[model samples]
Target: MLTDVKRTPGEKAFDWLNLIIVLVITFIILYPLVFVLFASMSDPRKMFDSPLLFWPKGFNLDSYVTVFENKDIWMGYGNTVLYTTVGTFINIMMTVFGAYPLSRKRFYGKGLFTFLFTFTMFFGGGLIPSYLVNQQLGIVNTMWVLVLPGAISAFNLIIMRTYFQTQIPLELEESAYVDGCNDYRLLYKIVLPLSTPIIAVMVLFYGVGHWNSYFEAMIYMSDRGQYPLQLILREILIKNEFKDMLGIAVDSQYADRMIVREGLKYAVVVVSSLPLLILYPLLSKFFEKGILVGAIKG
Candidate 1:
């Protein structure tokens, strides 16, 4: 025991109470995830009867098999993967370039350009007008429609510009300029390497947005084959007995499958989320630093 800092009995009791409070809060947040995992594995009938139980009853792979067997589900997964990867790449590049010039005070037409971009953030053409634009552009009824229309999100551009303004030192650009490096060279060699965290943050943001999109697909596409994962998942969740809008009958087996499909919905949630969930821990290291680095002073 050191003479300098002995704790009184009351102080020790407070520490124990704080530890208990923290553990309770942790359990409150985590219990729902744990419950979902249990429900997904448990027999559906048993799950309904005792919905709050902690353990599976008569656990089986039937739900997993049922979800996997749905052809649209697999296709949706494939489509989502392609959309997230391609969309994230395009998002990152466009945001970086857009941010770069806007960060500079001397760029020609900077105010006009910035106002134009920011203006879209607060307003937009109505849905019908936007659809007409997409149709005119020939992106409707095509895979590119899913990937292109809203490619450069305005909030992301503003964040990226703000980041560049606050974080990249002016002296670094001046140093590169003295070496006769072009703008592209300075950006690729100096700015991008130091901007990994923000880039990763943008990737997560845009990638998830693309993954979850359904409304644009609903209005713009006529082909079932072109439906993205969320639309397909919507069919599984809510369209079990509903006729196709074009007057097609819902297959009878589709109704029979709902018992297992309920569980499969949870399984799909796990599957749809697996990539981001796995990537998050890896990306979160960059994510935290990114938000902090540029925002602290600004």
Candidate 2:
């Protein structure tokens, strides 16, 4: 036989308070995303009339159709996919190569090398100097400019280094050496297999960074053909907003175009963010484990 125990009044009150707080926080976080989604599908005239939208007034695919009608959006998608794929590969390779040596106990002058790497994080030659350097190297206005300059992130390097040091046993390397494995073999075959979590985290980090980046493309790329998705989306949004403003100023008859622009804005946001929203869920398990184990453990 089992007996039921009653909860204390204080504990019940605390639980209810905690639940309320969590609900409030969840609402605060979710409302904007929900609002944007509903607003994009809603009739733009009705949306404007009612600023606070709990649900879509009239649902339609007009906004998405408008987004897809642009040829630039398709081009941007292709270019962004290319940039993100190649950039992330280079980032992972460079980060791993840089961090591995630092993690090794046998590597000489590791402290000095670590100091030099960390120094660049806090200080840099500034934008003009960097641009001048890129110009001298003839990488400006080229696809290489996007991938090369930022191939290795210092923060990510440190995180990976710490992961290797803490998670990978020194004895494992010694065992590999005894099995006639060279440094390269040990790294590719052994270290890499064991470091899946951190590698996945790096992929998510670098991939998203390259996917969402516009500033570098704006500064380095003059050709519209080479522009990434984010830069192209920015151009489209700005052009739409400008047209809306001009139309509103010129004639009241053009006010419908303004409403269309409002819907288009939220549609653009949804399209741009869709990839990340999909990707994060797939990587979430590894992401949490990697950050905690790699960053906090060491």
What would the per-residue lDDT of candidate 2 be over residues 175-230, giving only the tens digit for each residue?
99999999999999999999999999999999999999999999999998999999
Task: Give stretches of model 1 more than 4 Å off.
Answer: 1-25, 241-258
Residues 170-284, candidate 1: write the lDDT tens digits.
Answer: 9889999999998999999999998888898998889889888888888987998878888887776677522321124357755455456567767666667677778888889
Error of 1 at 287 (Å): 0.9
Q: Clashes in each model (backbone N, CA, C under 3 Å)?
A: 0, 0
On the 0 to 100 scale, the lDDT of residue 6 in model 2 is 94
**What is candidate 1's local distance difference test score?**
0.80
Which model scores highest in TM-score? 2
